[model samples]
Target: MSKMPTPPTLPTATVRPILDMNAYDGQVSAKADQGNDLLMRRTRNVGAASVLFYRDPIEMVSASGCWMTASDGTNYLDFYNNVPSVGHCHPQVVSAMADQAARLNINSRYLHQTTETYLDRLKATFPDHLENVVLTCSGSEANDLALRTAQRGTGARGIIVTECAYHGNTATVTDISPSAFKRGKLPDHVVSVPAPGKLAYGDDIAGGFADAIVKAIAVLSDRGHGIAALIVDSIFSSDGVFSNPRGFLRLAVAVVHRAGGVFIADEVQPGFGRTGDAFWGFLRHDVTPDIVSMGKPMGNGFPMAGIAVRPELLAAFCEDVGYFNTFAASPVAAATGLAVLDVIRDENLLANAMICGKYLREGLQHLADIDGRISDIRGAGLFLGVDLSPNGAPEDANGQLVGDVINAMRRHRVLIGAAGKYGETLKIRPPLCLRQSEVDFFIEALGKSLRECG
Candidate 1:
């Protein structure tokens, strides 16, 4: 008897392992670790330890052409890469990134036209009111500036935010985020109200929005608190307020204005072309936000962010105090952002999202009929969700069924995500460049996973 002969060692960079498993797409088989001993060692204690890691945890080594390839050599059709709004490693974006890095990767202090060009491109996308932009390194930072600008412009100390909505982890935003505020007790300046949920609010979406905004303003004002801003995610991405009937936000915006509070639209999650029909989710509301904060898809995963405030607010902020960020308007980031805009327009991804998103929703509804456990299926455009509960509107999953379903999907090689306070809803936020075929694949995987979970 003899031990099997060892294969000749391949270089660390070139070694590709044939994994014993499949990715979301089986045709693109994936392996956990090929030639890297370190990865295998790390996975022993830390990898494959969670429900989300049911499949072989192959580290993705390369990505391109709307798909990602893992170390095990499996290819995944990336429907959930919103951060890469344009696409995975799009050639245009890659070339721009390389070109900018080689030429001028400097900061804003050096009076460069790159920043102006980038800002102009962004401004052109929004309505006329949101004319001024101040660049930031992230959504959280942009929100921070937005808050400061609003406070300065309106001379208000009170802020209103939606329930369960996440507006970055910054101290200011955390205070306003009721769901996030429980950490150290909510900040005194922050007030919150229920986010209109799909099942709870139904078609008459205006029932609570305006009243809630007005009430929050009154509560703070009664204590001699000035109204600073009514900051909210254009569509509450985390809290499940995908869209209230047309006039919900419009009415809320009016109330905030009447109360002398600024309306800040946090577009971190729903900005760019993710919502499909519109460039920005706030556009769906019909009322213009005094300050619009954008991120996530701005640089297509390059970590660019900004505050597009009303010109008046900009002037007030300028008069109030100086504002600057070290990496704000960095040339490379601006170039990447510019390239993203060009690619989004050239590829007509927004129209694609609109059409594909509707089809996906209809497919999910059909799936719900097949699976009673599916409590609710709601969303706008590419930002969608499938609620797992007996009642279609459970804020939280009563049992482990929803969690189990998500885990099962991963096992089947589909990498969809989950959300809701109890992780009950299966959240589907695929990249904007996603096509109908990919969604069909996801829906099929999802249907099978749901049946298996039960």
Candidate 2:
């Protein structure tokens, strides 16, 4: 056999936990909003686990399209939420949920026409091979189920992921998500490779990424875990949005398959036309995932998620254990999900994402030309990552600079967030129904924010 490519030397930047990046630290920020009544109540309610955005979290009262109205009557252009993929408080989606709830809302165990219809519509979007769909209440549950299914199907405990990936919040999925860990290290059964980016792989991302996977497989086997699955968000959202040189994931996927492991595409971030290039992010890479886990935008914020798997794999897993969810595939969820799909089709949001994404990138490039601190811009469709540095050097990326810019953007009435290992990449994800005028507004706000931060 031909020798496998060697893994490349990676950067030494300290990886930031996904939740900690751009998050409000209660200890430090408490004094700023000390007299705020809502803040006091929230702190008392959720306490230490309350993760709010910004140094001063805005209290949102209402939202529509791509704008959110704060309690103080300030309307901010939303650029950080993907949960409302089609738009915020979409009338059709809300109406569907209400109508179904009024008529009938029952669990998946019951044979409901709306539930089956929604599943049929959803299944038509995937590859023909993924014939089985399992519904859940959240992306975390979907990922949890996917990992369990992969483990059962392959009889291996080992799993592989990108270094800064944020799969979900469940106990099982958290082990595989390096970005979710605030203190402890990943378990031995889980291994992570550097994300597919020029900083790590230089010119040959496909070869370098595949080589890393090979090394990870070797490490897992040596640890007596072997390989169960190689799962990832094809867009690599948390790893600074590495979505370029399409088909880069094909080789890495092949490596996993050769090692007798399944490939799970975590589409929680890049699914439902958010990437624009394809309906699902994996479709852009041209790789066949053994299982595709999705959520977040499934019901356009209605709390529904699921995994589409190969029939054989699902059957193999179900043979040993029974599975069911109390709220999954409910009539209300089905109606809401169906409406989301209809809105996507009717509004031509996919094309809108593609066109608006190009416009947004071009505007960002203009900003990059003027601002040396704008180190790099990466992403597809409405999801994007813009790196910030003290200078023009990407190796010297500055999370502090990003933090200042994010807060400044908020002051300019545009809300955004951070990503990447060092929290140096501005994670920009607006509603899919974004307009050109709104794009212009974001670009203007970003320019001003960069100037202020610089």
Q: Write the per-residue lDDT of candidate 1 for residues 358-414, one digit (tens) a residue.
A: 999999888766666676777788888667664333543443455577667765566
Scored by lDDT, model 2 comes in at: 0.92
lDDT of each candidate versus the true structure? 0.73, 0.92
Highest TM-score among the candidates is held by which one?
2
lDDT of 1 at 382: 86
Listed per model in order, the count of residue pairs whose N, CA or C atoms clash below 3 Å is 8, 0
Residue 137 in candidate 1 has what lDDT? 89
Model 2 alpha-carbon miss at residue 83, Å: 0.2
